[model samples]
Target: MTDTGMTAPEPTAIDETRQRELQILSEDAVLKGHPHGDEQCKNCLYYLDVDEAISYCWHPKLRVLVGQDWYCQWWEEITAEA
Candidate 1:
């Protein structure tokens, strides 16, 4: 392979202990389907849509893949910038 100056960015490493902690907190927070009709992960500020049905939660406390219809207590509505 030719030596290219470009390189892929390194992936962020999450230690096992931290990963476990986050998982526990995620479970405790009841990360699941939306409880209300209007609020869902897709509309949340932390939600990064991967497709029509799935999205990744970018919340610092909850970095995980989530369904578009799923939601959590940390959900915050995305606001438009002025």
Candidate 2:
């Protein structure tokens, strides 16, 4: 995976707009900052691993398809189901 090093969008002065932008931007930062290693989207709780190479991150703010090798700060170990 490639690291884009691109920063999040700057916050505007509007309170509501800034707050929402900050939230999304922070989450984006977390996703980009995650270390590239054994920790990957496939094993994360938020990932819906439907195939080997690609999967969906079900996070509310960051719903998107991620690769097996891609990871983020939001990653959590898969839990056992009852």
Whole-model lDDT values for every prediction: 0.77, 0.71
Query: How much RMSD separates candidate 2 from the native structure?
Result: 10.0
Q: Write the per-residue lDDT of candidate 1 for residues 1-82, one digit (tens) a residue.
A: 8879899775355676777876797797678766456878878888887355887788888787788888888878788961
Best by lDDT: 1
Query: Which TM-score value belongs to model 2?
Result: 0.54
Would you estimate the TM-scores of all the predictions? 0.62, 0.54
CA displacement after TM-score superposition, residue 16 of candidate 1 (Å): 12
Error of 1 at 3 (Å): 52
lDDT (Cα, 0-100) at 26 in candidate 2: 61
